[model samples]
Target: MSDMTAMELDEASGQAPRPLRERLSLGPFSDEWTAADWIVGSASVLLAIASAGFFGWSFVVSMKSPDYFQQAALANMPPKLDRIETGSIDVANAMPVPQIVRLSEPTPADYQIVMVFNNEALLATRNELMRVKVGSIVPGLGLVRTIDTEAGSPTVVAENATLHGAPATR
Candidate 1:
């Protein structure tokens, strides 16, 4: 075995010898990532989530209450009832209908009315008023409330704590 130190080997190879402490030095170039890097990365992630949440929430809220869709349905209604002369009803006059019901057959005094705005409704029969309730008609909207007996007598449950397409604020 040859007796030689690392310094001797380095010197023999015409290389500058490095001290043990200097060889073990931890400089910026040797670091994988700094505290500043972590802080900036975390901030970037937070900002992305915040921006997405802000826009996503806005879209969800708008979809929940689509006034334009409800308004369009009501606008197509006839100006008069059964050929009877009736003046033009304002948009406000037309009640928004989130749901509609059709009865099996038409009977005397058989009419449907809104019950609790989303749970049940009063269906007038010959003997008594029938309470008809159904599952959640609108997904986000809760249980049935309004009953449009003109069509199927199925009760409509909606969310928003009001009749589907109730009344416009303006």
Candidate 2:
């Protein structure tokens, strides 16, 4: 019975150590390459050739200017000149004069309600902005209260503005 190490087995299999450059080269296949290696190499070479051909054709087409066939057809035509009599009415209809219309800006609109407290002072809003979902928030001068517009004027009762009169004395 004989015992063989890893290096001895490698040498016995007739497989030699390759250089780093050869191993890193375009050799994805092994030494004894199967049918798949040849097919892959051929396909890769064809793909590279097709890519280079497409780029070369594109560059050549872009470098040269196009000459249409219409230029050659027009060259065979003869040149002629004609004259018109004095005050000849050649047009069928005359064009009307154009007028420029100037547009003006529209004026802004505002709605508000004034509240007076105890006949001494009053609260009048200068600028009031109201939206659909978001209501308006205005500070009072002599009274502090919240105004809700759910129903008609009945919703805005006098009880809502109960904070009238002057400040409380201590």
Model 1: per-residue Cα lDDT over 35-76, one tens digit each: 898799899999999999998986886798768656777899
Worst 10 residues of 2 by lDDT: 151-160
* Candidate models: Cα lDDT each: 0.55, 0.43
Stretches > 4 Å off in candidate 1: 1-30, 67-170
Per-candidate TM equals: 0.22, 0.22
Per-residue C-alpha lDDT of model 2 across residues 146-167, encoded as one tens digit per residue = 4433232212222223222232
Displacement of residue 74 (Cα, Å) in model 1 is 24
